[model samples]
Target: MSFRLNPFKVMRAVGIVAIVVYGVVLVTGYKKSKVTTTESVTKDMKIRNKDFYKSKDYKNNLTLPNQVVENNNEAVAKELEQTKPAETVDLQKDSDTSKQQTDSKVADKNKKKEEQVKLEMQKQAQQKLAEQKQQEKSKIAAKQAELKKQQQLEAARKEQAAAQARAEAARQQAREEENKKAREEAAKRARENAKKHQGSKKYIQVASVTTEASARGIAKKLGGNFYYKKTTVNGKTAYVVMSNMTDNPNTLKAMENQAKRAGSGYMIRSVGK
Candidate 1:
C-alpha cells in the first residue's frame, strides 16, 4: 500500500466534535446542579438515614427493670452455699426418736388443755361468789333502811308528846293569871267602901311649946284640911292643920311617938276639936 496523506481535514473534524461534546456536558451538569442543590451542603444539613440514627442511639434495651445487687456478706454466703457439701437425709435410722417426740408433743397439748379447763372453772367459782356477796349486801342495806325508818317514827312520836305537854303547861299558866286578876279586883272594891264610911269623930293632938315655929311646925306636920280661926292670946297668928286623930290619950301618945319618928323632927300637940 502506497501512502497518500490528507491530515488537515481529519484534524478539523476532531476539533469540532470535541467542542460540541464539551458544550453538552456543561449544560447537563448545570441543570443537574440547579435541581439537586446539595453539592455545597455539609453533614449538619444532610438528611440522615433512620437506620443510621438507630445504630447511634445510646439507650439500653437488655437491662432488667428491678435488678437487685448482693452485698459483701450475701455474696460470701451465696458462694459458701454453692461450694459447701450437701447433706443426705437418713430414711430409716431415727424412727424411735420421732415416735418419742410425737408422743411428748401430744402430752404437752393435753396438759395445756387441762390447765385451761381448770382456770375456766376457777373463774366461774369466783363469779358465783361475787354474785352471792352482792345479794348479801342488798339484804344488809334493806335491814339498815328498815331500822332507820323505825327510829325516825319513834323520834316523831316523842316530839309530839313533848309538844302536847308544853301546850298543857301554857293553858294552866293562863288559868292561874285569870284567878290572880279576879282576886286583885275584889280587894280594890273592899278598900273603896271602907274609905267612904262617915260617923261623928273626936280628935286629940299634942305639941311642944319651946319655940312657936316648932309648935306651928308640929301643927303643920299633919297634911289634911286645916281650919283657921282668929283668937288673940298676944295678937299673933296661929296656924293649925287637921288630920285623922284618935279619941283616946293613949292613941294620941302613940301618934306623938310616930310624929317624933318623922324626919320633920317636930312632936305632936293637943288641939281639941
Candidate 2:
C-alpha cells in the first residue's frame, strides 16, 4: 500500500515546525543580546575607572582620600543605576517584540483555519444543491414515464373498445341479413302453396262481416296466410276473412283450430262450393 499524505496534516506539521524554529531563534537571539549588552557596559566602566586613576584629579584626591573615595563610590553607584534602567528597557522591548510576533503568527493561523472552514461549508452546500437537482430530475423523468405508460394503456383500451364495437356491428348486420332472407323464403313458399291449391282446395273462414273493411281488419288481425273475400251472408252482400287454401284433411283441421283461436267461430268449405 502506498502512503497518502493528507494536506491538512502536512500543513499543520509544517506550521508547528516553523513555530518551534521561530521560538528557538527568538530565545537564542535574546540571550546573545543580553550577553553583549552586559559586556559593553562592563568595558565602558573599566575605561572610565582607568581614566579617573590616571588624571591630575587623582593626585589632588590623594590629599583628601576619604572624600574622594566617597565621591567615586557615589559616581559608580549612579552609573550602575543608569545602566540597569537601559538594560531593563532593552529587555522589555525584546519581550514586547517577541509577544507581537507570537500574536501575529496566531492571528494568521486562525485566519487560515477560518478560510478552510468556509471553503468546506461552501463545498458541502454546492453538493447538496446538486443532489437536490438530481432528485428533481429523477422525479420529472419518472412522472413522464408514468404519463407515457398511462397514455399507452388508455390507447390500448380505446382500440379494444373500437374493435368490440366493430365486431358487434358486423354480427348485428349478419343477423339482419339472415332475418331478411328467412322472410323472403317464407313469402316464396306461401306463394307457391297458394298456386298449387288454387280452385281445387278448401279454406277455413274465420269471420263473416257486412263490410269489406271489417273483413279486411279481421284478416289483418289474424296475421299469416289469411285474406278477405267478397261473398253473400244471410242474403246480404258481405265479405269473409279466410285462411290459406289447402285440401289435406289434417291441414284443414289445423287451420280450423288456428282460426277458432283467432276468431269467435270458423267454417271449412271448398273454394267453388
Best by TM-score: 2
What are the lDDT figures for the candidates, one per model? 0.54, 0.76
- Model 1 per-residue lDDT tens digits across residues 109-214: 5566556656666766677778789889999999999999999999999999889888888888888888878788777777566555633344534332444565
Residue 210 in model 2: lDDT: 88
lDDT of 2 by residue, 113-191 (tens): 6577667667777777888998999999999999999999999999999999999999999999999999999999998
TM-score of 2: 0.45
Poorest 10 consecutive residues by lDDT, candidate 2: 1-10
Cα TM-score per model: 0.33, 0.45
> In candidate 1, which residue ranges exceed 4 Å CA deviation?
1-124, 192-253, 260-273
The prediction achieving the highest lDDT against the true structure is 2
List clashing residue pairs in candidate 1: 205-269, 205-270, 206-268, 206-269, 206-270, 207-268, 207-269
CA error at residue 33 for candidate 2, angstroms: 8.2
lDDT of 1: 0.54
